[model samples]
Target: MAAHMKEQTVKVKTRPDYSKQLITDIRWLLWAVTIGGLLLAAYCIHNGYVGSLPWLSAMVGLPWTAHGVVCSFYLNMAKSDHKEGGITFESAKANSFVADETNTEGPMG
Candidate 1:
């Protein structure tokens, strides 16, 4: 027997202006630790504190490269979808109160 599938449209979430929220979600602690690790690695190597410890400097490289790749993917997606007439945050917020259905009151006596 053969099976059939029906096509459905998906509402993809897109943010018109994402910079502010992105800035708010940054992990400062992670950055500090990564940079501190690299600096410590340099210090140890400079002081001739040799061992495999210097390799810690590369600890941050992979994650940063991965982050760049992921960000690039999102940017490309946004560029490709730039022609879409998506609603902006401010407009969505303003329109949210119009049909909230919070007060489904019965007919007044």
Candidate 2:
């Protein structure tokens, strides 16, 4: 019968992972910052804001742009790999304490 043939059992699978989404978010933020900094620098240059203040423009724009570049590099690195899900903890108190407790003072003391 057609009804009997269509009554086969089905197994449902779990949802896909979201690590790729995390990396995508990081990359999007980095590019947004980079573009924003470049835009601000261009605005300053266009309005001749650098005529009276030389180092001010560089001080604000340079560091932000550099930070954006670094963030972009980190985003690229994060994109190269997919993270696997590790063991799940039953409760918060399951692994509350550290195995080693060696707290020492100053650099060489």
Candidate 3:
């Protein structure tokens, strides 16, 4: 009973430093873009544009990779803030103003 009471009194802290995590994620994405770009360049040089369709596709996809990485980094960092207590319904409704529900038939009908 005493041991159980002591265990219950102990507290556990689990604070995670997400700043470094975001940096590491962005760094990995940067490395991916660099490696993909180099591979595309090599393919372009070795096979020429006519035969480098696959490499061209990879090259086209590289920009999107960077964009997605940055977007995700921002999203993570933004979500780390706990002060706001999450998005409000008013803001969501204000930003999204669509038509209200309506019957498939005419309003009179």
Best-fitting candidate, scored by lDDT? 3
Query: After superposing candidate 2, which stretches have Cα over 4 Å from the reference?
Result: 1-16, 51-109
> In every candidate, how many clashes are there?
0, 0, 0
Overall lDDT per candidate, in order of appearance: 0.56, 0.52, 0.57
Whichever of 1 and 2 has more TM-score, that candidate is: 1
TM-score of decoy 3:
0.33
lDDT minimum window of 10 residues, candidate 2: 100-109
Give the CA lDDT, 0 to 100, for residue 97 in model 2. 34
Distance (Å) between predicted and true CA of 29, model 3? 3.5
Higher-lDDT candidate of 1 and 3: 3
Best-performing candidate as measured by TM-score: 1
When summed lDDT is taken over every stretch of 10 residues in candidate 1, the lowest stretch is 100-109
Candidate 1 positional error at 97, Å: 23
Instruction: State how far residue 107 of model 1 sits from its true place (Å).
Output: 47
> RMSD per prediction, one decimal?
14.9, 15.0, 16.9
Predicted candidate 3: what Cα RMSD to the true structure? 16.9
Considering lDDT, which of the candidate structures 2 and 3 is the better prediction for this target? 3
